[model samples]
Target: MVDKSARTPAETKDAGVLIVGLGRFGSSMALTLDRLGQDVLAVERSPGLVAHYSDRFPIVEADASNPEALEQLGAREFSVAVVGVGTSLEASVLITGNLVDMGTPQIWAKAISAEHGRILQRIGAHHVVFPEADAGNRVAHLVSGKLLDYIEVEDGFTIVKMRPPRETQGFTIEQTKVRERYGVTIIGVKSPGQEFVYAEPTTRISSNDLIVVSGHSELLERFAARP
Candidate 1:
């Protein structure tokens, strides 16, 4: 661990999301959350960066690894906090430890390596994200023509949008019995030249139609890959 002096200037405001670090990932997360009407408090070690983003949202110039600074900012009270110091593994780990010690309910951290991710989780970070790996997976999924869009709603289940394969065209929902046959649920459908409709027993599926389905990822992939 890198040793750094503690500094805690008085602060008066609280935020729904506490963002530590001002790197690309942190700044983007802070800005996007603020734009989405979330109360966001961003912390940065560099005064220059704090000044750079101050015009957009509330920013604090402080070292996230300093426990005093974190406490002064009421870090323990925030429901969610994200540690975005992947470039400096030491800093990331230190900040994650501080957040965990402060009892931040949910801590999401960015990690540059698998070992770094494991360390964050061991220190109680509720979630860890490898942005590069995640983006690569998304690109691979798209390139492989698996689906038009994919979003994992939870650990094992996902929601995906894709055009029906030629084999399933002209089949009614009841005839397909997707839920029973493929272990996936067709939640919604977009017919040719028409807006999307919720899936129903009588709804007819065509090759050109886009379907939105939700199920275990493996099952969904199997269903999508059928010849």
Candidate 2:
């Protein structure tokens, strides 16, 4: 519902989301939200970058580090704002502060380092994501050849997909005792042909089956490490 035509702070209208910076993280977030049918307004400082994505979404070319620049874009009306200036800690912190001052309901920021993330949080960023770190962790799991998928649902818990360990193959779901032993739950099974089935206590796990389970990440790692 944001008035894309307004390029000055004098205009006021409501918007669902505001994205600052159009790097990989920013552009990806905007596109994904747009794909999910959300209204998104993106801003980038580079004219060339703005031109490239101009046809894809509504974008404004401006320095997001400046509070007046964002205010002119009606940033205060957006419910959520994401600051994605990964390479510039100053820009990220400044933009996050601007959004916070504007009273945006939620503000997410991208950080390239631990210190950068802590600073953003200290300055009122609601969430800080480390894309490189997260991607590296996933790659490490997949490289091990046992893990197929990993989704971190919370700080300590995750939903993981992996090939059953040698000792777990041929064991019934109940026999594995994942819940009792590891505080995990076997959500489902993916058979050889890529068929998925809701797992029950009597479900027999085959060597070729991929198990989908959810539990504390440490326990899941322990389960996967078993022979």
lDDT of each residue in 1-227, candidate 1, tens digit only: 11122112223234478889988999999989978998777888887887788788777777889898787766776788999889988889999999998788889999988999999999899999988777786667667875998877668788889888666689988888888988999999997789889999999998879999999988988888976
- Residue pairs whose backbone atoms clash in candidate 1: none
Clashes of 1: 0
TM agreement with the true structure for every prediction = 0.86, 0.88
Once superposed on the true structure, which residue ranges of model 2 sit more than 4 Å away at CA?
Answer: 1-15, 193-195
lDDT per residue as tens, model 2, 47-74: 8888788878778888878898887677
Count the clashes in each prediction.
0, 1
Weakest lDDT window of 10 consecutive positions for candidate 2: 1-10
